[model samples]
Target: MFALLCQLASAFVGAVIPVFYSYKTIKKPSQKSLSYWSKYWTVFGSFLAVDAVLSTLFINYFIPFYEFGKLIFLIWAVCPQTAGAQFVFDKMLAPFIHRHERKMDLYVERMLDSVFTNGPTLALMVN
Candidate 1:
């Protein structure tokens, strides 16, 4: 039960909390900052989408797996350690991101291009 809650919280924190950090890091809302925010949201949203699908499948198919002590491992993702999410992103995920940097960039570019090119319906929802 506790671990289930932890899994839920982990997904929320991983996806939503980064926006706050991005805001804090950017002192001004210049073109660069705005673009940075857009990219940040894009990447985070993509990650969250993938995570939701995977977690749903796992929870549905592997109920017994979550019943054991293995669930404690999720704490690394859920708990905000002293260094915080940025540290984990930089130290853990960044390398993998860099390895696939071109693909990520292409995906973000195509996604943003499509969104901005279309009518402003989705834009309003994002705002």
Candidate 2:
């Protein structure tokens, strides 16, 4: 019961509120709104990735208060007063991404080139 409630709260905070604010941001473009949502989505994506990997690896293990903790974190992240997402992105993610962005871009370009060049061949092989 508690876990289910936590899930509901998390979804509302993490998804519903952002979506509402995102629509508002789209309607009225501003530097502040744009910056906040960008940071929110970046942090949200990072959280999802980490959660997915950890849950997959520890499927059987029980983590006490995980859902509640997640909800609290989401609240903190989305709350404008705290601006946790912005802080996290600026302090952590940005530097790491900046350091390896070139390498990542090169890999992505190579992958895309391969896909475009070998697309027909790959399709034929699949069939």
Candidate 3:
């Protein structure tokens, strides 16, 4: 079925390729490879966050062939010829993140502080 095929494609394009490429980059570091993968990860992470929220809200149900569309996007993101992830990061995500960088950092720091400070208490409460 289309859904199964899409899932397989998604796994390959989204996860397998990235993991392999990341390993290669780690093994042999170069400025070009580091820069490209950094941009790729930034864009990919943004996509995953947005996709999670949309899927949680069932927005995919309204869009026809959402899986196919997602597959195409994943391919575009990772495909060397297009360099879509870098394009997207430079054009969209970078600006947005830069603008909110201070606030986001503050929030993350606060959250981590809370977790570390209250971890034992929280764990006890959970049980």
Candidate 1 Cα deviation (angstroms), residue 18: 9.6
lDDT of 2 by residue, 21-112 (tens): 99999999899999999989999999888888877988325888888888999999999999999998999999988999999899999999
Question: Which regions of candidate 2 fall more than 4 Å away from where they truly are?
Answer: 110-127
Instruction: For residues 17-103, write the lDDT of model 3, one tens digit per residue.
Output: 998999999999999999999998888888889999999999878998898999999999998899999899889988998999999
What's model 1's overall lDDT? 0.57
| lDDT tens digits by residue: candidate 1, 6-76 | 55665556545655756665765677546544554544555566657866788635665452322243333
TM-score of candidate 3 to 2 decimals: 0.92
Candidate 3 or 1, higher lDDT: 3
Model 3 accuracy (lDDT, Cα): 0.91
Off by over 4 Å in 3: none
- Using all chains and alpha carbons, the TM-scores for the candidates as numbered come to 0.44, 0.82, 0.92
Query: How does candidate 2 fare on TM-score?
Result: 0.82
Residue pairs with backbone atoms closer than 3 Å in model 1 (clashes): none
Model 1, residue 42: displacement in angstroms?
12
RMSD in order of candidates: 7.7, 2.7, 1.3
